[model samples]
Target chain A: MKNKFIYLNNEEKISSNQNKPFVYLDNGATTKVDEETANIIKNNIVEEYGNPSSIYEFGLNSFHNIENVRNLIKKKINAEKEDNLIFNSGATESNNFAIFGMAELGLKNNKKKLITTKIEHGSIKAPSKQLQKKGFEIVYLNVDSEGFIDFDQLEKELDENVFLVSIIHANHEVGTIQNIEKIGKLCRKKNVFFHIDAAQSFTKVEIDVKKQNIDLLSLNSHKIHGPKGIGALYVRKGIDLKKIIFGGPQENNLRSGTENIPGIIGFGKATEIGFDKNEEKVKEMKELRDYFIEKVLEIPNSHLNGSKDDKRLCNNINITFDFIEGEALLMYLNMKGIYISTGSACSSRSLEPSDILISMGRSYEQAHGSVRFTLSKYTTKEELEYTFTCLKESVENLRKLSPLTPK
Target chain B: MTLEYTKKVIEHFTNPKNVGEIDNPSGHAIEGSPACGDMVNIDIKVDDKGIIEDVKFKSYGCASNIATASVATELAKGKTIEQAKNINWKDVEKELEGLPQVKVHCSVLAVNTLKKAIENYEETIGIKKEAKSIEEKAYDELKNVVNPNTGNMLVDDKLIKEVSIKEKKIILKIDLSDEDLYKNNINDEIKEHLEHLFDVIEIIFIK
Candidate 1:
């Protein structure tokens, strides 16, 4: 199923299913490229193969097309004309550049402290740790049991020495959406740079960079049904970021890399479909997510992980079942053709529970029992019903085999 | 395409065999814990002449844990007590066609739990190690019971608040929270360990 070259032609799109139902519930991991976006990518590959930097009509056309997608993304994010988007390999590089690029300026300005929450993705967390080696004080704000970062802690941590307050907009594991507007206003008031790792929430939620006062926003493509290896960092035309990745002065002397023409076009097309306010698709996702949660919680001793209200992402359903390991539940679901993910340590090489759940005050057992089913725009009621049925059977059967279950 | 696990692993994990508890079991054993992310509890019913009648298992682990225990229980169901103890991790792996290297520990846990269940039964019917004093007997019997807290011997932890043996009776006071997640595990461990060493085990939990 990990066919990287499946996009080479249309015939390869049909996987050998033997007619078994293939319910994809791991969209938080990555979404399948929609037909429109895939077609765009294929056409861009075959027709527009010129490098954007070449000095000819073909190259000029490619360069203009890249700029057109950039303009489209700017409109989608609703940034001012002064704001700029720098394309990169994905959110990982964008998050790195947003952090390390600012750290260089912060070092000269005596802003040695950086602020972030414990639940930020690894791109943020790992770089924060690296900065610590360079004598940068990184403060991790705490979160409540529902995965809400303490706003008061953020306010207290904001000081002249703090350079960046990078937080994940929607948590990848539990789907808890932070109050980004409030966070932006606080950072803007303090004149501190506020960055958001919006890889998981960029298209799922409505984001206005100017209204939110976001300084740097990390956006990715594959999570929103676009091709992978392409993302953008929206710089609000103010923060002077030192070039961490130095090269031939491409990306307007900001980020130096050859333009990924096809990737940029796919990102633009996917964002057009995602950020165009497709309320019907979003409503279906919300309804199906709620219905799946309700049906799954009908099983005894099952608890939802994140907020049950509008604060949570519409397509994310994370639940913890008592007396069962999340990895086992995932296996059972996989057997039933329900592809999902888990927070259990046994399935990981490090053997540590998810930091997002642990920071939310879930014990090791509770964290290990967590399962996340992230629906996509294509997810349907029938798929959810089948998932629910398989989920109930797995939990019941696995709980019977769990030593933690009372005899 | 097949997953890293073999077909038998997928089969056993999907619909495991003999995955439950045996009420009024002749011997019972629990291994590992939830904090470690994998735990196995095996119960056995043995007939006369040391022949295993029925065996069942419950797991708080992953696919490998459940499948390994399922296969181990199936292998131990009708075997004699000695043969059941000989059912090692390698045999479980071979039966499952092969477990991933990371999941090899799961097979070991299942086999250890099964062997411990048989050993507990061995002690119950006066077929285990010789004992001198009540404390020594209790310690020797419980020496193999892994601590649910630290994955060490249960005797290593300060759970025994007080212990006194009057004739054949062993009065033991243990300090454990009433709401301890592993309370039942400790109880099962105590009974499995002390049942052969003493005619009576008077357990009093200190709140």
Candidate 2:
């Protein structure tokens, strides 16, 4: 189960010496698209230029290419029925489509509430707020410091007025996995539509649509090392959603646009390759995440931001260092050709701290002081060691300049 | 996305100048606030000639914050007290070539902290200065604090709806409870500006 993605050895790397070695640990943001995935995308753009809707041999092949990928994802998730999935722009569109579709059903069924969580992606958070403006009661389920939502709260909120409940499968910031199976069952018991945004957990976490009773699941490429701008939504059968996109009636009238054949096929191949050795990949990343977290917490006044148990994603580590800020640390590491990211308010144009951290009961200061290091399967021990050395020095330097540091 | 900071800004951030405190300095002032995710303490040594001999800063902020402080310290070092007070955020931004537009505010904090440190030094050495009205003092503190929402002063931007000075306490009713990223920094800067004179400060944000 060794990874098919190979890293260049020391001898091979010697030719690219002199320049600082690049070590990127922001896989949670977006990964370096897989080599084979990129090649397929390039080939499709050059060779498979047939329109999916055209009635020709090339177009038929193009249409089949799109379906093949869709079927591949369907089988991966153990979806209940065929023709319930439709290709979309990406995770954002898929999520938006799911929410809007459910909103339509809710309005007709006399349901007045939509239940979601504070830790959802901005797509879900924004739309839920918009629904509130549109007279739908929006309930944001509360999560603990480790990001597990209170089931009691979910149960209490799942009244008959609730039509849809959407949650993230795995958090983008903390990488904490939710109990989707349990949530899906609870939603089923209440006759509510259960939706999950699984962009971060598609191949990384196991998802079973039928067994879990997930009615609407949002998925995408890019985060799984595939080409960007192509994603899909799985709408369970028996759920009648009115079509919102009014165009040339593509995607069985679910989505109406010319298909991105290259991205579709590229995503298909990437997800297929990602499944290869994924269990082993997860094991390696989990071990590395644990070891790295343990080593980092050795620094004075450093804290691990989330739990490090089985519920944590295999590749995520978020930490807050006392007396120093995360953006400064991010830049310091960036100076050494090592790139990581911070969830701090200073990290973005909007000066507010990370919502996920705040939702988990973190103080504004703690959220500002936090940095996230997300590893990929291709991350090497040597690269991590080098990162640790730089990180130690950077922390020491920043702390020395911090008045909060004890003399 | 990063701010596309100039090489000078990166260099200054990587190796900050005059870091930490100066032992028994003639003047010291801490700007920004920890609860707000940024605080800067500037310490300076002024000789009998009223020239700053040494300047240092302790910063808990982002890269631009540190870099701005470093460049401000570099600009303040060896300058006369009056000349140092004249140093502005624009001077710091110019010294670093340019900062990202949004990050230009950090330079404002740096320059203000330096000026406040110089003012403390002037007060310590028996330099008589006129005591301005509390309203004027509030205006002085918030002069450079801009709101990106309006590209104007925070007060002018309606971020702070009301400001009242009651006894020894200054109360500010700000309406940025929606987690305006700048809320903490603005709160800290106001406290930094007026906390020297006012013992009790309570900032309440209205919905």
Candidate 3:
């Protein structure tokens, strides 16, 4: 089959004013909505425009499409009949709903303690803190230098008062994949609800929610080459998750709104295609990512962040070049039409260093000098080669002009 | 969001002028912290009469630092030390068209280093005077000039500090707030304004 992904070469160098192919290496922030996904969205808007909540044939068609999408996701994750998916705006909203919903439920049961890691996404972090303000005790598990939460530390923190254990399946910045299965089992043995923010790892990592004993899972479509505005949270049937959004009863009153029909259809199509080609794409993306990592680290004074082995995601490569700023490197690469990001996209605009890296025990300077290059299935070997060339030159040039003295 | 740097900023950043260090320089100064991701080191060669013969800088920062420092050296070269010392960060920002709101600190870094270089030159030479000379008096008057961006007198805000003075060269230091903006051409403007009172040979600033 012909490659449907966008490809750019040196001859087609794109500038800000031009429409040309450019190297895209920041997939962790967001991926290009694949052609199939875009088409589904277009068809849904033009041909199947209906509010899923209305009691009519068109509305029923939209409602059926949403159910099909939910079932597809549930099947992909191996969720059992006990688990049901409810749609929300995206992973942030899904995560907030899961955390705050579970926290509220836990409060009624006299289980006022919440457990999570320092490496979780901001969406999870923010609501957990808000729970603290409402007199719920919050315990943050610290990740090791390689970005893995210590199971022993987690086991020690788990008790009857701890109502839920929320952890990121894969870190968005460093791409470290936590052993969610083991974490889930531990939480199950402790009789605590387990919530996984699998936004970055949903399809990439095969998650059997039933076998893993996951009480809740947060996922979004955008990171999986789907539409941007749709995501879902899987709540285990027995878990009492209090409603966070209230209005006309929708999603069985778990969430209430006119469902985003086009976004939902696009998400379903993307997931179907993503899972069908998962094996080949994983292999291709892994080889490219590893090769890029091996080659990029050859640049002097550059070193990788997170795991050196399989625990890291196949698509992620975060590295720090000593003596130069990451923002300067990002700017230089951006000027060359090689798009990458420094730190987390959520905090990139702020002058502060990556708090995630700081939590992993890196010094402020190391955190400040770090950049992330995330690959997608669309990334080809040739693109990786070109990116390396640009990166090496940019790093050398910025280092030459750097005032940070080499130690 | 991507910061929209001015075209001049892109130019100076891509092919920065006077981008190396000077050996056995008459004056030298460093400002900002690399740990915090903005820093600049300026070296200046001044004549015995206090004229700035040459200036060079090495910066560690985003595009703004390189651009602002490039413009700073271009503005200070061949000007009297007093005039160079009187240069403000606002003028550097103006010369580069304008810097983004966040990058205005780059201009402050450049201007502060230039003044510090002048101060280093004055300290190295035993050009101390028993009384305020004509050039020193002129510097005193020009020293109170307003920061173009803030519109406040430098003296009243205590943003500008007098470092030291020798026979013909004077050094001043500007302590920029974390939020100060940058502009260009304040050096030449100050020199023309003060030429009536002093035959100033050199000036430097430190921050």
Best by TM-score: 2
Fnat of candidate 2 is: 0.52
Q: Pick the candidate with the highest DockQ.
A: 2
Q: Give one digit per residue, the lDDT tens place, for model 2 in B1-207.
A: 435677678779888889888899999999776655677899999998989999999999988899999999999999998899888877887888777656767887788888888888888888858989987777777765764433445654566788888777888887766477556656766676677769998888685
Best-first order by DockQ: 2, 1, 3
Interface RMSDs of the predictions, in order, are: 8.9, 8.5, 10.2
Say which docking band candidate 2 falls in: acceptable
Q: Which residue segments of model 3 deviate by more than 4 Å?
A: A1-21, A344-353, A405-407, B127-207
TM-score of chain B of 1: 0.62
Instruction: State in Å the error of residue A399, model 1.
Output: 2.2
Better structure of 2 and 3 per DockQ: 2
Q: Compared with the true structure, what per-residue lDDT tens digits does model 2 show for residues A138-190?
A: 99999999998888999999999998999999988888999999999999999
- List candidate 2 segments past 4 Å from native: A1-17, A347-353, B128-134, B148-207
lDDT tens readout by residue for model 3, B1-207:
446676678788888888778899999988655545667889999998889989999887776778899999999999998899788977987888776655665676688789878888987896544666664566555542445455445554766566455655555555645333332233433454455554553334444
- Residue B151 of model 3, lDDT score: 48
**Would you list the clashing residue pairs of candidate 1?**
A401-B59, A402-B59
State how far residue B25 of model 2 sits from its true place (Å): 1.2
* TM-score, model 2 to reference: 0.89
RMSD of each: 9.4, 6.1, 9.7
